[model samples]
Target: MLEGHPWFQLEVLAASGKSAGNKYRDAANWILEEEMPEEVGNKQVEQIDSKIFENAGIKLIFSALPADVARSVEPELASSGLFVFSNASAFRMAEDVPLLIADINGDHLALVEQQQKSRPGYIVTNPNCSVIGLASGLKPLADNFGLKSVFVTTYQALSGAGYPGVPSMDIMGNIVPYIHDEEEKVEEECDKILGKFTGEAIEPLQLNVIASCARVGVRNGHLESVLVELETDATIDDIKNAFTEYKGNKDEALPTAPEQLIIVTEDESRPQPVFDSYNGSPERARGMAVTVGRLKLRGSKLRFFLLVHNTIRGASGCSIMNAELAKIRGYI
Candidate 1:
């Protein structure tokens, strides 16, 4: 997004110590080849150490580090007055940290002020990849009809495990029914993301969420089968219109914000990875939209399937948009 934005600039690329000579190095090289300018192609990946905090030119740090590594460096970076937008699970549920989704909860950015009380720099996080899509798909419904409870079964993409993930022998023809703490992350993060941010603290929504996460062989999009119980009565048209007319972040003017934050389809077999994986508009926002299909309503219950680009909308793109929202909200 920085590459396409007019106000921001990409200045540095850093990596963890263990990434040396690994796929992380190769992936950085690939990004340089495809996105970086010729003059910046030779820029080396710096170590994620204390010295990086001393770089005055660096104001914001975007981290894709594992939870442990992020937990180690993020506090130090924040103490040194550098804003950190992380994709790790380290500080996501902290009282002051905002688990942001840019469009869905831009207002939650206010929580950073609480962090600023202790340090000049603060940490903000994007929700887990699976939670992002599910929360996004549920946001409009929660707003329009009021969600009572949600049950979801996720068919998450392999890319969510990161580069060189899921050995072929293990995942080639198999669907792993469990993914460590994925189910818990989805259930908890959703409530937080959909919560009300009081002036002093976040009030998590009381709605119950049950999730079952499975790692599928798919390469990109994460697809979920969701059943929602609404608090009020609504027709099928009401639910579909909630999605179609939903414009959570479309007006944000962020380079990475999608034209449609949520796309509702009438087709019976849609929101599929093959055709809808990269759904988004305005070139820069590709792979940033959540696609929802197979909408069905029975009494107060609503059912549908949703898809999200796990690595993009669920991770990096989420951080980028959060930063953009921060900038717009003057929290940067």
Candidate 2:
């Protein structure tokens, strides 16, 4: 979608290994072949020859490969001097590497200068799906009001499990209690995305994160119930002001960016997957903004419910926005 921005026109030079197919490749092909034309018939999107990006100038590469597969391809792309923004889990925890949520920590890009030691590639990884929603919602609080810890229960979407995802028979009318390594990823990634960068390395926030993950029947969006422990004193009104009055790069009116990063709702039974999943502006709330509702204050802790588009903002949309931010900062 960043490539579709008013100022940016992208000619995708893409290829994939001979196999069933990858989730990213499948989705990109859908955008390139079906969705783009229906959305904007005048705009032209073409697929270039494989070697064109190698010989011709190329700005950046977004890797959606599985973690291990990304490890090998990333070096080659970087060796070619292409900036990489990866959604894969590989290198996410690297000391010198950056785990970015453009809204949360674009400063982490400063560490890109250190990529010279590794294949001339600078990689930035987006956090786990569950973490993306939690991190973005907490970022504003962490910046203005201090966040000390968070406990979340994620009702994740099936797509996060990947293509041929879960068996229908198992999930048709059921909810699975556990997802392998998912809780760990959510626990670790939230801190990383909300962490502090020391110029050369990132020190994840001291916020203690505990998570419980479940697989739900929803086709899109991950909904989380969060309990945040705050250090400084704050009231329900203060938290509401922080979220409702929020504006971001999307708000400042970046073409592909969402207008708000967080949306706080007063409706007690709000942020339901089927109901609010598609709310908000064209690109802003299409699962991009972290929808927070059911705010309640108990002592120093603030509790709320959140919903985020898993495949878009949490996954592909977040990656696209990061690339756009990098372009804005000239990192691409």
TM, every model:
0.94, 0.87
lDDT for each of the candidates?
0.87, 0.75
Against the correct fold, how does model 2 do in TM-score?
0.87
Runs of candidate 1 with Cα error greater than 4 angstroms are 18-40, 249-251
Candidate RMSDs in Å, in order, are 2.3, 3.9
How does residue 96 of candidate 2 score in lDDT? 74
**Per-residue accuracy of model 2 over 217-316 as CA lDDT, tens digit each:** 9887899999988889988888888886656544234454566668777788998887766555665436677788998899999988999878778787
The best candidate by lDDT is: 1
Q: Highest TM-score: which candidate? A: 1
**Worst 10-residue lDDT window, candidate 2:** 41-50
